[model samples]
Target chain A: MSEIPSKWKCAVIQLHSKPMQLEDNFNRAQGFIRKAAEAGARLAVLPEYSLTSWVPDDPGFADAHVDREYLSKFCELAKECNINIVPGTFVERHVDDGKDMLYNVAHFISNEGKILGSYTKKNLWHTERAHLEAAGNNPHTVMDTPLGKVGLLICWDLAFPEAFRALIIQGAKIIIIPSFWNLLDLTEPAFQRNPRSEAIYLESIVISRAFENVSCIAFANVGGQKESGFAGLSQIAMPLMGDIARAEGAHEQMVIGEVDMEVLQDAEESYKVREDISRPDFHYPVYAKN
Target chain B: MSEIPSKWKCAVIQLHSKPMQLEDNFNRAQGFIRKAAEAGARLAVLPEYSLTSWVPDDPGFADAHVDREYLSKFCELAKECNINIVPGTFVERHVDDGKDMLYNVAHFISNEGKILGSYTKKNLWHTERAHLEAAGNNPHTVMDTPLGKVGLLICWDLAFPEAFRALIIQGAKIIIIPSFWNLLDLTEPAFQRNPRSEAIYLESIVISRAFENVSCIAFANVGGQKESGFAGLSQIAMPLMGDIARAEGAHEQMVIGEVDMEVLQDAEESYKVREDISRPDFHYPVYAKN
Candidate 1:
């Protein structure tokens, strides 16, 4: 086995944003990221819809949504703390649509105050879709940083395998997901239980993403309830295995972990995860293509 | 509401199998399908690799595989039992290979012992890639029978939404997945904690499939270990729900349940599972399509 590299500690900032309180949510997020940095975490991830949540259909949210100024403020904080921060989703103003589009976004800010690329949530949750306009284009892109190739995605995107596969194809060694996941009952209760905790399905997708792509996945979800019954439960998963570090119960909290790129090497050597074990011969098409 | 179709009982036959043992396995599967039919089931589905598991390492599997004779027996059984049977998969004697190439296949048989159409497994599992040959060009085909436009796929195909979408495009109102699901630790533990004693992941897939396609899904899994540590645990899941009838414990067994085709219409109309709620605008592309 190859020698393991110096491990990088990551803090998953799981918290509860009392909807529409921009200042309060920012303070809470700032506090958690600061603690993670103090604990020697090289990077930290915040939850989805954290920037300007309380803004519902009411105009209050329109006034409260996070803007360039808010992101710049957070960038200044990242510089001050010398911690790489993965700021969760924020309602931002789009260039094309002057109207505020709820961008389930993630910002990668370096400890040295360098602003990395931001990832707008590719797949929006149902509620978010109602309020936010879909990102028409802008495919999954990776940011090359000291911490290896980092891929970013927002909440509901994790449910789809193809989205994550796109990130992996872009040479992302670590995939970060910022989420605002809600638990709810489906159409039929007689058919299934555990409606409130779709965590298992989420975990499976993350695990498969990591395993197939051979990349580390860091998922940071906020804890606590908003006007809508969204319970926060942030988690970080290593490549090939799901849920490396997870916070239990719905509480305002943050989870910290490390992404050792060398682990990918080890898992590959041990498990042959990338080996095309899929039977392409049996794939659909009906007739053999020469 | 359009005059509701008469309530039809559908059985999802989970078929866990040993690597080879074509004759014995075929006989066992026949018995279960017959039992399900006798119990008033109008449709029955078997699991992937039911005819012959793709474990290429098994010594007896290569030569002792089932052929025309075995299928002839199944045809006879379907006729005698007077049931609609979907044989999960079988290793067929390749017309050209002569030696015996594994074809992950599904056979649709009528109550009158007539062979309806057959759909080969499209997406083979990763593990099978090591031993089993890839099946080229299998398209999503639907069987227009009494149980609605029944779409059929093997195990891995479910992972790819496009495959099921093709079936839906082809007018498949219901999908039957005959699978040999390799159980992990979490599945058994989750089942142990549940009243129905079924894996949460299995239920998740069934519900997700039903929701995404707006069709009823009846998935049959193999039970009964041949060489592997665990095998049998058959179940039947309805649209937008979970397993209504399932087997218990870790042992091999047959399970049966009824799926009301009307549930699809109900889920689509009042529940509006896939259409009303599912917002594909937020979709992420996983694979790089050519």
Candidate 2:
């Protein structure tokens, strides 16, 4: 095994984004990014819908609300800090013909103020289905970056293994998920919701996702009491080391995670998850066509 | 909300097979199955290679050792107990065009002394590749039983999500895994290993696999000190209940798990994991063939 020089540190920013306030959101994001840079983080990540309070229903919201400013600001911040950044998600409006359609798109920006790629969350929840359109084509993307092959996903994508496998097939070593995963409790008091078990559910998936893929995962989520209140167990999990760093529940915090190639290599060698996958065609039904 | 009559209880038999002593192994299995029946289990499952101390490097092992008696005995046991039994795996020698090849096949026996179906494991680990063969044609099978749509897989198949997804697509409400998941370690005595941490890794996958697929999982494994000391964390995790019961590490024990339709329904209704999988086409690459 060759000895590497320095470990790549990643930062997950858990923010309490103000409702409908773009200026304050970016300001908060900027402060966190600067702190992450000072702490020697080469890559900083934010949560899904970090700009505003979790998007509630408003038909004309996408057409009137979203702007190009968020992208420019994120690019500028990435360049200023000399670090790659995933600045959460924006409600993007697209014209398919004469109609305005909305999508939840996450932008990946490099340290050189260049847009690497963007991916829309394919699996939309019950609430999101009312307004946002799921991606018309493939939603998974693995962009080659200086730090690693960064795969972008958002929120509910964690529930789907196919998303991760798609990226892995395309050579993703690091998977980044920007999530606004709220504790989905029933609105009425009489509904009988189990309040305490949400973290167990979310955290279990996070740790297993990293373990099964044999890749580094950056799961960033929003903080504070919103919706049913976000379960802010924002974490960065390596292949072998379960959780490098994790945020407290519902607390706005910035935690650093070290992604070392050696640990990843060791885990892969020990488990042989990738190497053991000899017949991907048999497991994956898609390959039957050829 | 349907008021179901009685919960279907399933039992996972964690065993320690005596090396090469086939009679002693069956006697052990018979005792566990009896105990499971006494404990009110409708479906009883055993660990992979539970009939022998896991197949070692003996080229003539399958041809010389394996016989029809094991199958007849298991079928008789299932009939005697009147309980569905997945009697782990057996090394069966198959001759195609007069050539002898070996396969580790999991046999599904009905409660009426009839062989329901048999499935060979698809994903073979590094160690098994030396002696065994990877499945060639349609390795995935979901057998319909009175208890549930039972999906069969063994050991290392847990590492692959496609196996689970393939079964889920076939309407499997309960997935049964007969595993001989030997504790993966550093292989050298010089490399320090933490025994306690293995359960956490195994249990996490069990819980997440159940949650993601919205299906109940019956994970059975061998119990004893052998290859890297089998991590006997055999568990039954419901979609909502997580792990209803799990074996203590490396302990020879039998545990009961309730596979209630109401619990499964409630979990699906609340989380909507099955319903919310809208973009299966995009997420699953195989759907692109159409």
Candidate 3:
């Protein structure tokens, strides 16, 4: 047995996924995987709704919008790259909706290209609730990888701490979020069609979750703009008691980094704030409605 | 009356005050006021504890440490510049250690250099419970100003929506807050601290107070450090359907802005969100305690 443990390297790609362009989006995904593997990344994550746009009504496009063939090709790419991949959010025809309506899904594939598992976003965004069906799953689960155990939570799922906590309880060392965050929604509201002041709200949740969990968080997002207008900002953050890294804003290209399991290991020792500070057992009655 | 009524420009100076060095702190504040007056600001505010640090048991410190001679100097300055000044905080000397050990106070002085009224911080921070004593007072009472009816709250007081609502109920068109926020302490270890991963708990209170009340908010904060490393970030945020302007990072300077009473003359008519969405009576309970 080795005295020193090995470190795990993960890559995050922030891209502007062209809406409804399944072929182009798949190709982009394949390219990022190849580059990450070539650069020695053991795993890589993509943004939520990367298979298509978070744009309204695109999931219900023509009959040829999303299919198994598209996913099969992507799976082949993951196998060829020999690295774990989180192909962010995509639309899958729901059984209850008679395949007429779809559910927002996250696909996790192993380096050997075997389907690990999938998670559907539990708390659908107000905009999403307008079109998508809320999934019945718990939305928190950990996958056993060669480097470490990882958890998966989609875009809007960041707002719910309980979901991420559930995954951590299942022994997740790092949390991966695939997001298609539209920038026009927050910063450039004056010029966008639909302006949103929810950036503070979303950013608060992301930051608080990292601090509360004492784990590294990597979020890959769709950035840049479309011919139709709308953009995104991707970020990676760590609320560390010992080692914290937070980087936000537009990163429309491939970005790579290591999850640094050592950070999590050291966090176990340095979390002074978490030691008997928040009395959740007592605050439960108070915070339940909030 | 002229076609264009006389305008009132306000400046909220967010200062980072130290636990010691009273002379230097006052001089730095004077510098900001001079600059604001030169830029045509008629009214300005300072943050809570701008006179002294929030910690207890520092040498030569008392709960009520309001020095009358120094206040006279401020009155002289306001009179010289023909400006209105809000005294952020002071150590008001008191008779009862239990009743008024320390006061989180705000002094609204008119342009004519007359003391209007003072609003002590009603909602004390967690640390305040141990370091200082809370003062009992009317939650909200509007002050008649030459410009309009103005309302006030100290740092922790802003967290209570009812305080702002009480001000609005009395027909306050403008709200001012003098804050002394220590960003470093806001980390998890401090119960008074919000998670620093993002700026939610702090930013949300300021943003919500402005949006819900339909009144302009001018927030001044104490900045810089003295003996310790406490810091501050302050700004003057306008009342819009969403956030108007925000200042991030350590702000030891003055933030000035103008708000046209006409903008809120028919606020319910202009902002469709406030007109259609807001229900003050149905406000969900905020600020729950364990």
Best by DockQ: 2
The lDDT of each candidate is 0.63, 0.76, 0.61
- Tens digit per residue, CA lDDT, model 3, B181-269: 65544433332222341234355445545544667787776666433333444655443333444555554666677656654544433
Taking the candidates in order, what DockQ does each have?
Answer: 0.16, 0.34, 0.09
Question: Model 1, B93-123: lDDT tens per residue?
Answer: 4654466566666778776777778877656
Per-residue CA lDDT of model 2 for A1-290, tens digit only, reads 12322478999999877777778888989999999999888889999888866646544346434567778988998898888899988888888769878888888898887989899888776678887888846546688777767788898888888778777766678899898877654232212334534566677788888888878889998887644556899999865567778997687889898777566666676677765443455445422122
- For lDDT, candidate 1 versus 3, the one ahead is 1
DockQ of 2: 0.34
- Using TM-score as the measure, the top candidate is 2
Q: TM-score of every model?
A: 0.78, 0.90, 0.62
- Which candidate model has the greater TM-score, 1 or 2? 2
lDDT of 1 by residue, A1-290 (tens): 13323588888887686777777888888888888889988888888777665345867664454446667778898889878887787776555646545555577887777777887765555556677766646767778765777888887676555566566555677888887765552334422433443444454445555554567888777677443444555776654344568777667887777666665765555334344322253233211111
Give me the displacement of residue B241 in model 1, in angstroms: 3.6
Alpha-carbon RMSD to native, per candidate: 6.3, 3.8, 7.9
Worst 10 residues of 2 chain B by lDDT: B187-196
lDDT of 1 at B193: 32
